[model samples]
Target: MLVPLTREKFEQLIPLIATGPQYKYYWGKFSNFLQRLLISVVIGAIVLLFKVLFRVDFPLVFIIGIIGAFYWFWGPVFQASQRNIKCRRYKYSGFFRGRILDFWITEELIGKQETVNNKGDLVIVENREKRINLEIGDDTGFIAEFQAPLKVAYKAISSGQWAELLVMSNRGDLSTIEEISDIYIPSRDLWVSDYPILRRDFFTEVSSRLDDNEDEDDKPRRRRSEGNRRRKRDDYRY
Candidate 1:
């Protein structure tokens, strides 16, 4: 079942949604550049050590110059040039459909649902247990299983509601999800091409509901004031 919030709440919560991949790509490139820069420094130091130890006529000036050029120019240039490089585009035709709403997980509940396919006398069974439920928060409140929970969480950081998440699992367990809030999402690489329309719809409904609630709250006050005015007129006439 999709749950809708009022407009005010939707607006407040919309900001909490994770950011798209475009933002992640930018940061990812910057991080890669920093890593490369560090590696280059280490390589330069090794080259310097080799020149001193071997007493070889290594062109230290030329090598250092190239490294410097890569650091100051090539790194940023390569990153900027690749900005327009398209990775993979998802076609929203069939097979994959539906938008992602709110994602939540409780440690207490494991996979409970399972299904079987019927074929004549024999049947093939499979465990369709849901470890994570992605809430589309709409009229139906559609919930779906998230196959890649960690990736979903990473995407959620960009969506803006990273603080609401609380991950818990056993210590030393690599598969366990850990709660780490206030995480900065790297750039564009973090997003998928297929945008979740369900999430958008959910927020729209939430915003509408909030507006309705506000109107309802004002109605009673308006009626009370009108009643008081009527009572005052009656008292004066009497």
Candidate 2:
């Protein structure tokens, strides 16, 4: 069933969708190939171990050779078939729109460093109010500590390129994106829910306008502030 999602919720999902499983499907063939190769190696190792331990003279080389060939040629084909089925299921299932906002990569420890200011003072950063620390182990054990404005973190589970349209609020805190399966927006959040008022193309236009506003206002404010600070410092006596 489709559950209604706010604009903030949708925006949060986009990054996850782009860098998530749906995106991974773009190179699904290569991923499946590697999985097959790894499985083949494990099987070959087990067979060789059995032959050494049991002294079974069963045509070990022929069996292992055939297993390797099967995996190398057939694994990806099977995975591709499975992927297609899964895609269809999701298509029929409820879907949502999630748009990607800013994307950045930083060292894992930067979050810790930011906790305290340069003056060795404890600084309380408001955004970290409900921060959750996540330890994910894949490439290596790394900590992910951040506030996912809405439920955007849920969408990050998949990997690859994604595009979405999100909702924005005047305060910026309540803004979010929604993900569309294709180019068309779904009628409802959950497949069974009644359609809410649809605001197509709203986020894209809003974000552009917001960006333009910030660019225009920032330079003058920065220049005036810098000049004021310099004048104050110049008037100060040692």
Candidate 3:
């Protein structure tokens, strides 16, 4: 299902900027905080070495302090700005309803982790994790493939399960999809992605409204048989 997102619907979706998982990005995660601290320490150590070796005057304390302060305060602000820009980019987006054509999982190496062995040696171990892949399509003949971290809910997803997305198109006709939001599975009440793209509450409300309207318009009605009508007309003419 595809519906053009009008100005009214777009306004309703504006609140999404302040909702969902704000810490989905790297800059908003705790690991980024630790990385910044490590970087500041390394820079401080380099400054100390320079002062001892060349007798150069550099405010080592002030330099490291500034770096730490910038990272600590600016990271979240930058992440928010990025998200806002993204949401605005899809202001003219359309709503899409599709079905899961297929799904599977594969193992991939993410990175290497460091650990100490019983022999008192540090070793790097490869980190491998399973990622779920899904193929979704709709009546419009558009098909899309998405892959993300494996979630427990994904196990229950089978073929023909319903899914939803926010689709961006460059044309007014909304014929071609330029971008898409993370897939939302209504059956599982799960958004199948590592990061959240849509505001859960608002998205649910909008989807429910659209679904109800579609149901009302698609209700079946009885019609007289065309073959019987044509036979009666021919008999009357003869």
Candidate 4:
């Protein structure tokens, strides 16, 4: 079933910003930063030791760095997947209906911080381009938040446009959307009922009943009837 999300309903359902302070990069604000620095130093020492001991250009060290960065940046999703695998889990989820409160698209130039204003429109203030984050909110508060790409943020989504975000609960990840469009959910019962009408079989039966007209040709009348039936069907749909 296609359930359209109007602007009012969208605002009502979407969540607002979480209360209190939050650690954007990692858990345990101060300790996490120290731990990260210590880990980086340890890794650097290990790289140096490897170079001294092996006496070889470790070209693959950069590859390991890349992989580590990937894991660190997306640790939640990777950890969730590992947990699901251990538990032998499977899952199903309902369509999350929400409007595009706003969206952030990355660009090469510098960008700024965006906010949901009093009019419920997403706005950005001109500034530096180092930070990256997107906040989705409703009347209650901000519901969803995701870190965006590194660069200028382009096109904060307009307020009150209907949209549905399909998600997989099993292997959750920061899978971003490229495009969105209407998705049709067909009903078996509706298809069976409309098969005859769509096939113009009703006109076939009407033509058969009119075959007894001897003085006049029934083909013209049948064609006319079929055309009328098609027009009626179109009008009913709209």
Q: Which sections of candidate 1 miss by over 4 Å?
A: 1-38, 57-95, 105-238
Evaluated against the true structure, the overall lDDT of model 3 is: 0.70
lDDT by residue for model 4 (133-237), tens: 344434534244444344322232344543333222342221332222121111111111100111123223322333333224335664546576545333321
- How many backbone overlaps does candidate 1 show? 34
**lDDT (C-alpha) at residue 59 in model 4:** 75
The lDDT-based order of candidates, best leading, equals 3, 2, 1, 4
lDDT of 2 by residue, 44-136 (tens): 777777778887877766677577656755554454445433332221122223322233433332232336778888875543323222221
Best model number under lDDT: 3
Which tens-of-lDDT digit does each residue in 1-238 have in candidate 3?
A: 6777775565465443444354445455577788766765666576667668887766865576566545654555556557655666653667778999999999999999999999989999999999999889987698888889997877778999999887776676677777677888999887887656566677788788777765654555523376854443233210
Give the clashing pairs for model 4. 15-141, 15-142, 15-143, 16-141, 16-142, 17-141, 17-142, 103-157
lDDT of 3 at 4: 73
Could you tell me every candidate's TM-score relative to the true structure? 0.24, 0.24, 0.67, 0.25
All models: lDDT? 0.36, 0.37, 0.70, 0.36
Worst 10 residues of 1 by lDDT: 87-96
Instruction: Report RMSD for candidate 1.
Output: 19.2
Least accurate 10 contiguous residues by lDDT in model 3: 229-238
lDDT of 1 by residue, 1-238 (tens): 1122223332232233233432343335566768867866776677667667876775765577467546633554444334322111111111111344555544433345444546445443443433333432123332233422234544343232211111122332213323211111123323222222123333344334444644664675555565764453333210
TM-score for candidate 1, residues paired by index: 0.24
